[model samples]
Target: MKDLSYACSKFPAVSDPTADEVRRLRAEEKLSVRQIRARTGLGRNRVHELLRGVPPPEWTRRPNAKDGLRAEAVELRGQGCSVNDIAQRLGVANSTAYQWIRHLPLDADEETAARRRAHSKVMTDARWAAHRAARDEAQAATHRAAAGVVGALTERDLLLLGAAIYWCEGSKSKPWRRQDHVQFVNSDARLLGLFLRFLETCGVDRNMPTYRMSIHESADVAAAEQWWVHTLQLPATRFQRPTLKRHRPTIRYNTQEEYHGCLVIDVPRSRELYWRIEGLVAGLGAAIT
Candidate 1:
């Protein structure tokens, strides 16, 4: 009623309003003194003083331990405490404790370093000797076992069995070779018996009618067939006539009488059994090798 604008002009323009206006605005608009300063563009300190109230600043200050503590942390690490023990005392992670310890001296006394070097060398040598002895024993045992088994079979049987094993398990298969049956090529009788026994152990029926044989042309083919016939109790019809390979002068032919021949064992759908045998062979290979 008495000129409110002129009365308000007594105070600074950018500063807060008078107490009467502040009370009137607080009652009318329901704003705190800090909220009033934000809406009216008034100086923070002047607004609070004019409204007869105090307001805290918007930003907060955080406290940190000074460098004095870090220096002490480093000193504690040099006194020979382990990283775990240090971390526990300092209330820090093990990695942080290790970081502090890494700054310490790496040097140790000559006697202490020499003892560590000697101990390490001795342990390494002992481990090597143990492994060497085990390897030699395994090799000797494998050779003896193979020799005993092969000795029981005739020389012809050995060659045939070896050839069959090589064809089936050996890495000699070519893409052009159409023959998919299990074949072995070797002159060693003991190896042949071993292969047969290995097959028998893999659930191949001893009385299965699918068993067959084939031999080389150079050797006594009839005798070879008869021997397998008597041994496996199969008919002569199961034996395939030998395939003769002619000799060449340039090709080094060490064809000994001992080179009995090769053999082919026929079984319909033998692939499944072949896979099972493969797994069995693989398990034994580590010990054999």
Candidate 2:
């Protein structure tokens, strides 16, 4: 390499003195990457490359965190133990054990058996299932705690929340054309339910929202229609003819059975409600800041 600076950057500046100092500490002092970075003003990447140029010491004679487990790992590998077995026995990570045993010699049968064990579907599936269970438990606990924090929403609280949701997801007026209508469209059943509750809090009549399903023509249109109908419990009279989106070659990932499409809830002649929602959203901004 021409210079450390040249290696690190596209265009080298006047040779950096700090790079030389890092090299001196790395070579002469035999300092580790962490120590070099802590003891010098040089960056981590700069320090890393400098140390990487030198061969690792034949033996890490110095005591380390892994010193207790290293001998056991080596012994296990010599006895034809797989990396996973060594890791489990030594209470070290699989990657850590692999790094220590990677250069060790393995007989043909031992290597083949290890590879087969590693690729076993039952073991892999069990590991993944356990990990997913733990993850789901932790996530559900967090959600429960968060839900407890928001014990209940009063009418005013619901009003503010609905306005914020409407501002974020509902249709709005543009500068070119003035269209003040309270129209909310979403694929999420939970969000639509919350919006419905918000509408009730705003003194909107229960039968006010006109429902329309916007879905792909190729989807189970009747099933989607039934799902929305069952979800809202609104009369068939309030339902508009479902707007079918033409199938396109570019469209992907939305052809699954669970893809019920989006429901558009419109309150015709809702100019006053739209303005009120806008004001509520503005008030929320003022209150938040």
Candidate 3:
């Protein structure tokens, strides 16, 4: 109080050179907070306080692929575009697009008449139905035309075709051991029925063969047996107890309602019939050659 100038000279004032250095790097060097921290060893909060009111450089903003999308969403929201429209246009999920533009109010147009909104199931089906119908009709026409080409079969034709079918599908006697019985196993009901017709043509009794069903343990054996009986027009007594194949849960199988398993046709005392099938197969090979 006695002498202000004299007191000031006795004690020199101090300046924050650290703060000046931080500002210099931030403004002139255009270094990010991380870069400044690396260069100056200043704490993050301190550096941030020093950088207050100073906009960060573009590179320091951590721009990414979504930044453009966010900016576009904001613009769309300002224009009163629905979140649904924004999502479809931006190729983003509805929830994501909502997060981007939730602050904006939806317009009254969303409450318009239902006829114009094509969100209904009927409207969706209408668009593609005609095309599907036309394709189905064309396919059915081809099937009908092809079916007409195979008119009727004579007894000789049945004998040849059935013999070839038996050679391909029916079990044969191996050279290592002697098996003289006729055994045919097949899953297709049509093929088995055709084979039955072939047996009738050969003068073997229609009821001579023993039938058994091979099915998965997981399937309804009784239902399957009933299905076969109904399909073949054979008595339930004709079918032996089904041979249940072990079920492997890890592997997917045809276990649906329509999955009736293979039928085994075992004709006992058919050594003569087995030899006849071998001869027919030999004849086919020779005819083809």
Among these predicted structures, which one has the highest TM-score?
2
How should the candidates be ordered by lDDT, best one leading? 3, 2, 1
lDDT of each: 0.58, 0.84, 0.85
TM-score of 3: 0.55
Put the candidates in TM-score order, highest first: 2, 3, 1
How many clashing residue pairs are found in candidate 1?
13
What global local distance difference test value does model 1 have? 0.58
Measured by C-alpha RMSD in angstroms, how accurate is candidate 3?
14.8
**TM-score, one value per model:** 0.33, 0.57, 0.55
What candidate 3 gets wrong by more than 4 Å, as runs, is 1-131, 251-253
Candidate 3 per-residue C-alpha lDDT over 71-132 given as tens digits, one digit per residue, 9 for 90 to 100: 99989887767788899999999999999888766554655424345455577789879998
lDDT per residue, candidate 1, 1-289, as tens digits? 5778866768655733366576555566667667777777777776666656433333322245534545666777667565667778888888877776676642357786577669869998898998989999999999999888855656445444544465455433246964334544444455555665655655554454243344444557667666666655555665555666554445435456444455555555565554544554465566478
Candidate 1 regions exceeding 4 Å error are: 1-181, 206-218, 231-235, 249-259, 281-289
Residues 1-289, candidate 2, lDDT per residue (tens digit)? 4657756587666876777787777667767777778898668887777666675443434678777788789888999788889989988899999999888965457778677767786788887998899999999999999889987889998898899888889999999989999999999987888889999988886588899999999999989988877876666678899999998888589788888899999998899999999899888889889
Kindly indicate the candidate among 1 and 3 with the higher TM-score: 3
Q: How close to the true structure is residue 183 of candidate 3, measured as C-alpha lDDT? A: 87
